[model samples]
Target chain A: MRYFFKTIHLIDYKNIVPKTVIGLFIILILLIPVFTRNVVTLSTLIMTGIWAVAAMGFTLVLRTGQFSLGQSAFMALGGYASAILTAQMGLPFWPSFLVSGLVSGLIALLVGMVVLRVGGIYFSIITLALGEIVRIIALQWEPLTRGSRGIIASAPPPIILGGHELVNFNASLAPYFYFMICLVAVTGLVFWRIGESRLGRTFAGTALNPVLAEHQGIYLMKYRVIAFTVAGVFTGYAGALYTHFLQVITPMVFGLWQSIQIMIMSIVGGIGSLVGGPIVGSILLYNLGEYLSRLDTPGLQSFLFGSVVVIVVMFLPQGAGLVNLWERFWNKVVWREEEYEPDEPED
Target chain B: MPPAEILIEGLTQSCIYMTMAFGMVLVFSILGILNWTHGQLFMLGAFIVFYSTTAAGIPFPIGILLAGLVMAGIGILIKKFIIDRIKGELYIGVATLALIFALEGAASLLFTSDDRGLAIILPGVLNLGVVAISYQKMAVIIFTLIVMTAMYFVLNHTKVGLAIRAVAQQPVAASLYGISTERLSLIVMGIGCALAAMAGAIMAPLYPINPFIGRTPMIMALLAIVIGGLGSLTGAIVGGLILGFLHSVIAYYISYLSEVVLFGLIILILLVRPQGLFGASAK
Candidate 1:
């Protein structure tokens, strides 16, 4: 079986089973809407997807060796932009949605240009402050954001195929689920490409040793800005989708806590694989949070969340997250790979 | 010109920020990772003081001291078990961040989330022509001054302080010189947390206490440290004072718009001086 697995080359796999399994897993997820359209299940999955995108963005920024503590601020910016454009100004949902991501990306670009110049704990502190600033703005800017009362966002209009409604968002969540799947897929694909490309290598260089990378003629700020901006764009999209799904945009929705949540999701998921880590981490943590939230306990969710993170960090130690465990299992149990060490000669 | 009342409020704000910022910067210099639970620790400190003073009938001063000692013990445990074991700065940060939720959650569960006011520790007012400051506020200021002085003396004049400064400057060399970085870290963590607890305990009487009250002050302290320059004790003080006064003056004129303006100022400051006002250039 090992020999057979080694013989097949789907993408550069010494072991092909994991790849095939991952492909099958994606197919199965795509087929979830067909199997069951249960509201509870679909909404949970939708939220997981939204959070996954946000987590992926966070992981991408982390790739460049910069900790972004205000990721939710971008989410808020995106949500508010889309919410105001659609609900207040009466713009079409689809166009406003696109604009939301762009608006978020633009802000990230501007902020990144200024802050990425420093690129350290300073960046982290500034971003944290940015989250609070965005929240305060959303709260005080009553005419636009409707203050703390929140702005209600309408769901996407139904898709018409040959004069018949194909997917009506308001009628069922299946459409929304499919939409979420597409968003995650697109984001995953782009992130995966980035990770596989030279840009990703440059990001690794910057992260591992800034001085060495700079000496190698890599403009650290440029790559940092790029990673931050790209993450911002997708985070914005995720935020916009989340607002439309929830049908409301409130200042209370995204702030320091949400940003921390995104950071936790990304870290717990493992930063090993850009796309896979975030999806796995967000799905696991988000589902866990949802379950805990339903228990009617005040602090159980937080306590459990903290405990889990603490445990993961203690065990994982490095950048190895939950995905690392899966890899270890495959290598040790399934592959039965033996350790390679040269024998030492004793006198 | 800002009124004297605003200046007094700023002073009160600055004292809290200075204590919190000072402790945080000290910890960061030694631990090399910001204790994300610093705020939660502050909250716990307030809870501890409130219970001891009100329920246990402990004297107010003694209650504050108890809060500090307990928090120091907690901080030491966190450093030894959780922080010390975690390798890498990023992971340590995430670990501490998780602790925030855990600590906050535990606090909420144990104390409940309802607002509980600390019985007035000092019940009087210092009436000046321009403004009359409450005794509680005055206590906060005086307590902060005493703490700051004690810290300055310790950091500058003591053997342990010398070890701490050496470790912060050169960890490897300091370790080689027989100064146990591990032991020093534990002490620093204890001191940092105690300072945070003291700040919380001191401020307890002035505001309604809850498990979540640590959030705002934490952010303010964080901003203070950033502005003053991370890892610089004097910078933390200066930064705290500037932020407090700036916050009050801005809020007074523009109300809630102060938050935006404060953040804007941070960005501006960073653009001009990335290392902060007192921070040395990054290596």
Candidate 2:
């Protein structure tokens, strides 16, 4: 009976409420398509999801103690790869999408292997330079990338199940919205799992203190490269999805600003819970941006975004972003958690 | 195989990059963070110079000086309010980056996004035997030389220079020796920004002045500092010259491919010597 009761309790007291809330929130998100078919609303949600994935990737790289300023380069690589394969080479969309991610991952692995050897501010500068190089290549390589003119990508073909037209991309934004949800779910699941695993702890070790982690038998470069390559793969997928959704692939699509945007999202979202933080951060910021852009006030978006970041950093400090507010609310109010105190001495 | 004109142009480019890089290196050595908004500060300086000289009818030299002083004041305010409160290196860098968008946005809204010029400040060309360079370009070069010499004198000889160097090298030790790191940081930040502004103000005539004009110079300065070695002043100058000459000569030959080649070269150099040419080994 005790065992049964314990089993019913499931896990620690801390996780139960947050987990349940998150699960219910996800279900609510999944039902969003049914409730709203507004193009602006759906597209905003889709873009938010894409940015979230990218932000998650940025946070992952940060977890390994390396600041990657050029993550958007991988996105460009993926977008260009998928665009070339599908639009130019007449390859199927699904296969091209997977291939794009692989190609991006391969490039990332190679770059990480070489650059992670330096592994500090130098690595960051190299990544920044790398983003520029990729953009330049995309711009100059007209034969491959269609130069600055950009390439038009077609929508994914409709899904046919048992001789009935099921999900159609051409019909409405619903399919794209659902697709984005699935991608975010899968990416978030994988990232959350990694965070729960021993690998996450090792990553923390390296990030907290590299020298101590190294002395403890952790190969710093290997772990750093692993985190980077993983991030590259997902960021590539996000890029491919973004390209296909926009129905265009151009050198101007991804650049230094986008890279910085991803960084901002990660930082503002709070790096505490990789999955939750990015999703929340990107959603809020992307919506804010969309609204600000609609106002068409010159520089307002930039100014507001900058001000938000400054305010967050000033108030939160560390990596404690907006998500920290949620955690604080839970601990301070809902849970009524007390400060650490030792039990009275019984002896 | 580039002509003397390109060489002179490269020299002018080198001067701008060198000044920018020197400021960045100085800031990095003292503040322990990369000021990502340094580029926007440069743009602000150019605008100050442009408006002062053209609209306010200030003389060119006075305009440049005004730009420097105004930028220095702005820099001090930023350091005091934003940077000082930030704890970690990463957050501080991001905070400065935030300043970039804010500054750029403010500049765009205030100035409108049109391209402006200051070429009227120095109109005529001075013809040398091998190459005829514009007077504005010549002035840029001469002004840079004077600034560099003056900076060298101040840094090497002045008591304040000793204190600044002391703080940069060992902040805790400097504090023990009755030097205030807080004061030094503010001064360094001021001077660093002033240098960037002056460089921008001087170059306003040579290039189109827009809110976005600061981007390329910022990138070039960053590259120069990295190539020269991050914390080394001399390295910044050498790197600036190398990058400037390489940029002009190569662009003259192959046009846009120079950037790719330049990045490739930087990566190769980093692969071999990670700390840069003059940078100290990683701790």
* Pairs with backbone N, CA or C atoms under 3 Å apart (clashes), candidate 2: none
DockQ values, each candidate: 0.57, 0.46
Best by lDDT: 1
lDDT of 2 at A10: 9
Residue-level lDDT tens digits of model 2 in A1-347: 01101101101225526678768976998899899989989999999999999999998888877888999999899889899999999999999999998999899999999999987778888899999999999999888888999989888889999999999999999999988988898899898888768887677667777887889899999999999998999999999999989999889989888888888888778776668788878988888778878767787778887887787788773546677666666667887886322232211
Q: Candidate 1, residues A1-347: lDDT per residue as tens digits?
A: 01111111112223525677778987999899899979999999999999999999998998888888999999999999999999999999999999999999999999899889987888998999889989999999899999999999999988799999988999989889989998999999999899778898788668777877889999999999999999999999999999999999899999999999999899788875688789889999999888888867788778887898788789883646786666666667887876322222111
lDDT of 2 by residue, B105-127 (tens): 88888997799887667778888
Clashing pairs in 1: none
True contacts kept of each: 0.81, 0.60
Off by over 4 Å in 2: A1-18, A339-347
Q: In model 2, what is the error at residue A9, expressed in angstroms?
A: 25
TM-score of chain B of 1: 0.98
Give the least accurate 10-residue stretch of model 2 chain A, judged by summed lDDT. A1-10
